[model samples]
Target: MRHIERQIVQLKEKILRVGTLVEEAISKSITALINRDSALAQRVMASDEEIDRMEVEVEEECLKILALYQPVAADLRLVVAALKINNDLERIGDLAKNIAKRVAQLAGEGPIDLPAEIRTMATLAQEMVRQSLDAVVNGDTALARQVREEDDAVDDARQRVRRMVLQGIKVEPERVECLLRVNSVSKHIERIADMATNIAEDVIYMVEGDIVRHRSSDY
Candidate 1:
């Protein structure tokens, strides 16, 4: 392979590494929240540094490629996507960490009924993140578009969670603090879904040279 091509390949690998770390963090945070596993939540929080470091590494490599090769066309798009996706993945990692923090707070609270919608929302958000990364790996704009479409389901689920939490707060004022934490977790998961959608849009841009951001689904 040519030198620039090789660097681009490495760049993808590095970005995917960050994705893997962020995915694991998200999964662990959700598990910790549902199980009330403070130890596991701490583990997720601890790994944020690694994810942040990997993101920086990917960004540096992309800048290096851009400076050395001055890549244009598809190569430029790939590097640009890598840069944006790296930031998104890092933000996802931070959101997962925030969820872990909420889990830690709830771990000591009185027993509270967890909402089913929260689980559904978490599942959809995680799937979106996974599929978005897959789209990046395969350069599959179809998969990327599907990821974009799935964001709506997550948003709806998040709203349901918020309503359920609000009702719970009204019914059992004693559990208000815990329910608020649960709502915060749901919001974090929703933000993670948004970041995943951003990554998916970046993938579409990388592959089709189409800037689909801020556009309707018709794009």
Candidate 2:
């Protein structure tokens, strides 16, 4: 392999490492929330720094490849897609961190009934993130499109959570603050699903050279 080819391989490995960290972060955050494990939540918050560092590393590698190789055709698309996907992954990490923060706060609020819809939202969002990364690694546009379709399910779950929260607040007026925190978590998970969709869209662009952003239905 040529020097640029070697660099590209290294770049792919780095991005996959970042993705693995992010997926674990998301999973741990949700587990923290469900179990009200404050220590786990704290760990998730602390690990955000590592995800941030890795994101910067990935972006720098992309720029180095672009500057040194000035690759065109598929190579150019791959580099550009990696840059976009890196940003999305970092933002997903931030969202997971935000979820962890909420979990920490909720842990101290005594016993409260967590909504089932929130769990559904969390599961869908996590699946989306995993599938999106898989789509990128395999250059699978079909899997990418499936991720896009799954985003709608997450959105629906978010809406269900919203409704449940409003009813919960009405029924247990004293727990208004706790319900609001749950609402915040639901919103964050919804945004995470959005980030996953964005990554999936970038995968399609990388593989098929198609700009499918804002055209999820057409996909």
Candidate 3:
């Protein structure tokens, strides 16, 4: 195999490895939130630095490829997509840390119920991130489009939480602060899903050579 070809393969493996770590971080953050496990939340927060470091490493590798290989065509697309996905994954890690931060605050507040919608949104967002990475790894545009479509589901889940929290605060004004925390967590999860959609869009661009970031329904 050619030298640039091998480097491209190695780069692919590196990003995929980073993707797996980001996925685990999201999943563990959700688990920690639902179970109210401070230890797990702390674990997620502690590892976030490592995730950031990995993202930097992947980005440096991508720039190295772009400078050294100056690859064209599909190879160039793959490297660019990896660079974008790396940022998205790092942001997702930050979102998960945000969730973990909320979990930490909740631990001090005694027992409080997590809205069903929040849990549902967590699961959906986690799935979106996982499938987004899957679409990239498999170079599946159909799956990428499917991932895009799923973003609507995540948005719906977030809105549902908003509605529920509105009603909840009206009835129990004393817990308004807690309700708002729940609202913030829902928003964080929504952002994570949005980032996943971004990754999926980048995957489509990588495979199909089509830019779909700001395109509408008819695009």
Candidate 4:
């Protein structure tokens, strides 16, 4: 590989490293919340700082490649995709942190059974993040599209959670506060899924050079 290509490869690797950290954070955050483990929640919260640092480093590397390489064609697409994916990963990290914060707040409260839908939502979002990163690493647009398709499942799960929460609130008004927090968690998971979809779209653009934003129907 040429010098520029090597730099691009390094940048890609760094992004994937950051991606892995974010994915782990998401999984651990959900586990902490469901298990009501304050220590695990605190650990996830602490890891967010590292995730933010990685995001900054990845962005800097992309900028360095852009300035030094002046790449064209697919190389240019890859660099741009790296920049976008880096942002998406950072946002996902924040979502995980938000979930951890909720977990910390609910730590002392009585354990409320998690709605089944929340688990489904969290799982689908986590899968989307994993598949999207794999798609980028492998330059597989088909896998990217599959990640996009999985976002719908997350959405459906979120809607189900919303309905369940609303019903819980109606039946037990005193639990409104706890139910609201659970709803927020569901929303956070949905946003995580959205960010994963964005990353998958970036991967598709990098591979095919075709923009899929605002045109999910075609995919």
Each prediction's TM-score against the native? 0.98, 0.97, 0.97, 0.98
Q: Where is the poorest 10-residue window by lDDT in model 3?
A: 210-219
For model 1, the local distance difference test gives 0.91
Write out the backbone clash pairs for model 1: none
For candidate 2, lDDT tens digit of each residue in 85-134?
99999999999999999987887799878888888888899999999988
Model 3 clash number: 0
Local accuracy of candidate 3 as per-residue lDDT tens digits, 1-219 = 998989988888888888888888888888998899999999999889999999999999999999998999999999999999999999999999999999889887777888888888888888988898889888999888888888888899898889999999999999998889999999999999999999999999999999999975235
* Candidate with the greatest lDDT versus the true structure: 2
Q: Which ten residues in a row are the worst by lDDT in model 4?
A: 210-219
Model 1: how far residue 186 lies from native, Å: 0.6
Candidate 4 is scored at a TM of 0.98
Q: How many Å off is the CA of 77 in candidate 2?
A: 0.9
